[model samples]
Target: RGSLDLNLETLSGNLIAQNHSFHVLEKISFELPRVELCPEVLKRAKSFVLADPIFGKPGPIDVLIGNSLFPQLLTNERHSLGANMPSALGTIFGYVIAGTAPCLSTAPRASNLAISLLSTTDTDLHSSLQRFWVQEELPVYDKKSEGELACDKLFETSHTRDSQGRYVVRLPFVDNLAYAKLGTSRPIAAHRFESVERRIHARNSSPLKALYIDFMDEYEALGHMKKPPHLNLSAPHYFLPHHGVVKEHSSTTKLRVVFDASSKTSSGLSLNDVLLTGPKLQNNICDILLHFRLKNLVFSCDIRQMYRQIKIHPDDQRFQLILWRGQPSLPLSTYQLTTVTYGMNCSPYLAIKTLQQLAQDEGSNFPQAAHILKHHSYVDDLIAGASTEAEALELQQQLIELLRLGGFELRKWVSNCPKLLQQLPASHQEPPVFLQPSSDPMFSILGIHWSPVTDCFKYNLNFTSDAPTKRKVLSLIARIYDPCGFLS
Candidate 1:
């Protein structure tokens, strides 16, 4: 939180954190007043230097030290890394490995790295990254942390295998949410709900109502909610109902119905305030992008409603409650989200973890699809290309089936292969939605526009009446997304 030492480079020409655009920065050095080894032990240290802040702002890492120092700091620390480390520093992280799993390197020696992190990037730029995880396996994960324990609660007894040996998460169905604990139904929570209710009534717009209907329909269809019971024994948790802002999709309006998890009950704790934002999941965006080249027969597809597929554990469903009514004239009804919800802090972890778990569960039967599912996809979007059309088609079929085992569906398929696109029904070949004008004839592959018919990437610009100054032009130019670095 203190002011940062702005000088960030050593004249010796080592890259502290340089991109290829990295010209030799002005040499510099600085000593930290005290790099805390622990609250008890302090090491006055010399760090090479932080680089110029991207966009003139400090990065997540305030200081840059050599990798050699990592082995020493971790080896000498008597307590688990989570303890003793000041909460202000947040936490240390490495990178994503298999299916939405973020890993930290804990071992001191290079030999142990392979065992601990279990994955590596495939190209030249990540060579240094490969070194970060080279050390040995982590010490046992028995380190007690509120975050760790919360994650532990997920794996406790509720997960099992189906007859097909697919891992299935057993979700709890409840007439209502339980709130004896967490002070969920207390007056303060009710007040928060009242505030949301007031806003919806005040707006009273048709588009807003459409969003509400879409949300309630989906909620009921999933069996994650239902009509209020006439009578019930347990005091189900009462979560404040809130309508998400309306988003215009094509011509249709959609509402993201969510419970105000951050709303406090009389207990003064919002659901988010109490929950841990579990371990980071999902591979690096760059890692995912790097693999999506137009090698030969490339294709991409999105996992429909990625988060809704993972069913929350029944024990945990009590935490996801909402209040709502189908008609404004009707009384507000209580409903609980039986499945994982979008707004909850833990949703990403649960969803990604569930995906990774599916890959692990079925990898043996479908190796190629599993590999793409694990390392190649960015969350639900899968980008992969094969050396031949036949190979790509085979990969596509296997991918669809593999995901289906976990109650997931892969749709919105697009490909450079005409045969592949033409062979599929009209639904699969539906023109790229909202990506470009129909006249432009471009298909979007993870934000890059390409001509699937021509098998080449296309770049186009739509001018919005205003001409820009030189600096503005440069800024706009940089906004374009090109992951292959073909321009470079």
Candidate 2:
């Protein structure tokens, strides 16, 4: 008999041993042709098996609503309450009393007659009523009438049940719901526009991939969240150190990209083999320092969703974890990210690494050009900087390609420059067109506008410039200040 005819499940132990003794394991290894698996095909296969009508159509939700393992068919379709009583009212009473479900303030107001009926069954009903009902001027319930007012009172309070019967409290459902819908609608519509814009501006956002290796303890220690709630809500609080170990150091013309390790979490990198390798450190420093030089230019652009353009290696995805609808979804590494969400430790390094790689390819084609690209993550802000119009353009081109490589698509990037040049007198010498961006809020760099109303830039300025010399001096300023009266 062929070995294939043997039923392993039904085979006796002696028969199995005899077969194993006679059988020789075939020393065979076949290579699978490396074919790219299409996601759509796999999806179709899984869906066909899982959702096939041959497996039987999905029954009504109520069919399996409350089935338990031991008493699987415990169906109590008919209620013990009188059939004349409304089913909804009978259910409400049964749930509140027998199931120990709490009653809402609306419960009492709606079932005034029911409560009185319950009082006859249980002598301590008055005490239960007093405990749940506060001594307020509540609207009277008429046993004879069922009006809109009665229905309104019934649903007025959001209620819950505890061991002690039920409790009811006024909820902020109206405001919360309105805000939720607004938030949901706005993002959906904006994202639709963004999708279209991203396709149009795909070239600008491509060649970047980022990783966020958040030194969590350090950021917390630095008090990135130290500010009071009021200030935190108004604006993001940077995890920058100011006092003690983190005092601002002297400025470097070459662009100092220092990872302040003097702080407590300074040694945190050692935990995850995230050593600042010589080349990686050098690249990081280069990205940071060059950003300073780029800050002085009038027409500066930001690569939209730059970090998300970087992909994290699939093998390294175990670290990235975030909750979604009570389930873990987002990974800690930018490598697997599909959206540009904030807060990741490795995002900066990953993004900069991707950009550096892109720059290498772009720069290889233009060896003699002076181009610089800088990236940094003060938490989630992936700042980029480049010198010269050509360099900036190159950087933008490389970024677009890099982002596409990393699997993210982006839209048009708007550069912010002062619009004052448009109003300049014909005789007034206009500065080179390359050095200007619009001053209007709609035209500022990094997708932020200058808030003329607030006399400040809409987003936090990571770098600034001021010069004592007659010529335009280019350097990062000591601290970001109010943009109002900037010339003075």
Candidate 3:
């Protein structure tokens, strides 16, 4: 139906309904064979069923049809719904999806109605809303500007060194902040950190230790982390009211490092509770993919350590502190992360803001590559295509160089174009079949396991030692993150 909501309540997961209208959600339509009801049957159905309100009298109704009854109205004779609906509605039917008259918004309690003729034959419906909002503009509505006058992200920075001679960034408190009270003093989650730290040390699993080592290596290399003195620091250096947790990852045996920004500091508030989850800055994943497929020659690459590449204000480093120890015998040492760390509330905003800033600043020099950077990238991942192999190769080089201009590294280049792949280092190419995860070639494209070689998606199912349960089955199914609904 035209008004089916994704969250509509149903006894079976598979939904089948004649009519549903949810004002809280939205609607779409698809094409279908046009069918019409006889006057007598249509009048009876309308008098009995279609007379009810749609989501509580959503203004005057233009058209009404009880889908369940409409199916029974069709006869041997077939009627086609073609491009002549405009003329038919004007001369024959009473109400239409459009109006030749001006917008009703000029009068109080006045609103416009939009309707779509849907096909009952196809369940997988996709539609375009571009032509639906073409009614005359009666008045202007004010909207917010792109560049906010006073943004939460705006900050002042200061650089200082801890006793170990390691630099610590300090973001001074905002003067006019009232909505979210981020205490000047960060509350330490001492017990939580100690408990987790003790578990990691006591369990002493090889994978856990290895993950930590890898974390430290990258932490040090990026200069995001620094070792503080064994003793406590003086006033003004905030510990950032945060902690760490190791999360389960399916791909590799080793877990991933995650900082718990919600950890209560010495103050009652956690960083996440106070920080703003900035505007969604990147394009939709579907839009990005659609843009990539526009050209014949296609290739994709990702920025290495996407968040780590963007440096935060030096003054803000003190808020991202964590405790660490190289050896079991050694005491837990204090360390401050200087750059954008994973699991922070504003990490996505900072990362995306940086990427957009780079594109906006250097876009003129590399127009094509810059356009892709501005429109196609989802966070750090880049997907772009060109009509010709030579154009594709040029885009790749220009993309890498343009990103490099801002000290960003682009690696793991894969291409449908053989010429472009040849230009990249062998290390950047796809792994051999034998080394792949399975016999099926399911390489990750924007987090979905897709076959670039075969131009389709790849799925893997495996056995588990865990006992069968409803929750477990649901969890496994939920892990199947196919946002585009390609499986359908």
Top-scoring candidate (lDDT): 1
Q: Give per-residue CA lDDT, model 2, range 127-213, as digits (tens).
A: 333332432224343443333233233233332223422122221112222212211112222223333333323455332100011
How well does candidate 2 match the true structure in TM-score terms? 0.25
lDDT of each: 0.55, 0.28, 0.54
Question: Which digits, one per residue and each the tens of the lDDT, describe model 1 over residues 1-488?
Answer: 01122322232322333331211212222222212122221221111111220111111233444454344323221222233332112112211111111112331221211111222333222332333233122323345566655564654446765564434453222112323434545444444455555455565565665666777787798776654444242554546546576656422225676655666554444566556566666665556655666367888888877777666555556556666666557776666676667766666766777778788878899899999888888777888989988898888888988998887877777787877776577765536643455654666766677676667667766545677776555544555465555554
lDDT value, candidate 1, whole model: 0.55
TM-score per prediction, in order, is 0.60, 0.25, 0.58
Q: What's the CA error at residue 343 for candidate 3, in Å? A: 1.4
In candidate 3, residue 267 scores what lDDT?
Answer: 36
Once model 2 is optimally superposed onto the true structure by TM-score, how far is the C-alpha of residue 383 displaced, in angstroms? 9.1
Counting clashing residue pairs in each candidate, in order, gives 10, 44, 15
Candidate 3 lDDT (Cα, 0 to 1): 0.54
Ranking by TM-score: 1, 3, 2
User: Candidates sorted by lDDT, descending order?
Assistant: 1, 3, 2
lDDT of 2: 0.28
Superposed model 2: Cα runs more than 4 Å off = 1-298, 326-344, 366-370, 374-412, 416-488
Residue 213 of model 2 has an lDDT of 17
lDDT of 3 at 443: 54
